[model samples]
Target: MALVAVLILTLLSLGIALSGTLTRLLLVVVPYAVFTLFLAGVVYRILKWARAPVPFRIPTTCGQEKSLAWIKTSPLESPPCLWGVIGRMALEVLLFRSLFRNTRLDMGQNRPVYPSAKWLWFFGLTFHWSLLIIVLRHLRFFIEPIGPCITALSSLDGFFEIGVPTLYLSDAAMLAGITFLFLRRLIVPQVRYISLFTDYFSLLLILGVVTTGLIMRHFFPADLLQVKNLALGWVTFSPFVPQGVGTLFTMHLCFVFTLLVFFPMSKLMHAGGVFLSPTRNLANDSRIRRHVNPWNAPVKVHTYEEYEDEFRAQMKTAGIPVEKE
Candidate 1:
């Protein structure tokens, strides 16, 4: 139901833009507003997480602690220092090391077996990396005299030379990855049971965007120069809806705008939240250093000496040995 609603909304938006009823509004105002909202929302979320105080050393450990000199410790698994934490975070962000080690349980004849879920990790990694490449490939539209790095990446992505307008591998990989992920949620009973409407909605929305983009790229073509001009205009703050940019492009932009507006508010913000996760970012140094709670309140403590002094008279009356005597 949620996926259907999102798809309808996207299609409706495209219809409105295609009808030329809100060309300027869709092209200029919507994009600008969405971008502003995306920035503000992301900032707000990060600041909220930043203000949260972690009063204890609670880094999730998966390996031996740093104790005896002879015993080897896995620095990346159970980070004991800042450098180890950084390295672990790098692997998590770049390669999704933790997810790569994900395990799935299977039950057979009243016994359970754990197996590595490498396929999920592979699809997830491919989806993210391909999406990133596609986004970077778009930098050519926004920037003037596109850098060598972007050019090199674009060349490599489109190396197949299958069609007249060379097809990029990232597009296919992204689509395949997304489809597999969506199907996985539906096919797997456990996953499907746990899945929320937003999960399906997000996947469908991204798939819609990618499909529309592919259509514009191959089937119903748009003027690349005009699209670039429009992008440049937006960046320059002198926004202009370029001529010859068809309804398909407008639809594509609408999907992108919707994504931007929804990103921070949705589970997609995990992209940023990963960096703030206490378990992943903090060093496992509880044994090495004492962690004092910054918000701890002052409390009056009764000393053993005070207790002994108070009981001295009672002890003497009972003919008991007293410290004072």
Candidate 2:
């Protein structure tokens, strides 16, 4: 349902743009608005997370701590210091180390056994890395006089030379990864039970974007010069909706705009949130240092002396020992 809705919306957008009435609006104003929203939303979320107080060092530990000298400590797993924390965060951000180490439990002969979930990790890694590459590959469209590095990256991505236009491997990998991820949510009973409309919506939206992009690249083949001109105009702040750009291109842009607007408001904000997560970012140093809650309030208290003084007469009558006496 989510997929159908997004696809319909995208096609509707294409139709609206193709009518030529909203060409300027769709190509110029909408992109500007979406970009502004994306920037503002990302900043707001990051600042919100930054202002949140984490009074304790509560990094999630998965290995041995820095205790005895003879015992080995897993610096990445149970980070005990600032350097260790940096290394851990680096691994998490760059390689998704935690996801790579993910395991699944299965029942066999009435006993549970842990098994490596490498396929999930592979798909996850492929999805993220390929997405990054694709985004970078798009720099050619936005930048005038494309850099050698971008050219090199593009060459590396299309190294397989599979087709007439030289199909990039990242595109296929991205599609495969996204398909697997969506299927996992749908096919797995436990996952399906917990899945929300938003979860499926996000996946479907991305899939729509990828599919439209692939169509434009392989099947329809939009005029690259016109597309680049549109991109360059937007980047330079002198926005102009280029003539002769196809409906598929417009639909692709619509999907991208939708994604940008939806990104910060959805689970996709994990891209930035991961850095702010106390569980992933903090050092596991509770054993080495005492952490006090900075937000703790001061309060008036009744001392033992005050209590003894107040109860002195009652204590005398009851023959109870009193500190005052």
**Which candidate should be chosen as best, given lDDT against the real structure?**
2
lDDT for model 1 comes to 0.88
lDDT string, candidate 2, 101-165, tens digits: 88888997889988888888899999999999999999999997999999999999999999978
Among the numbered candidates, top TM-score falls to 1
lDDT digits (tens) for residues 128-236 of candidate 1: 9999999999999999999999999999999988796889999999999999999999999999999998898788789878988999999999999998888898999
lDDT agreement with native, every candidate: 0.88, 0.90
TM-score, each model? 0.93, 0.90
Task: Give the poorly placed runs of model 1, Cα more than 4 Å off.
Answer: 305-325
Report the alpha-carbon TM-score of model 2 versus the true structure.
Answer: 0.90
Given candidate 2, what's the lDDT at residue 260? 92
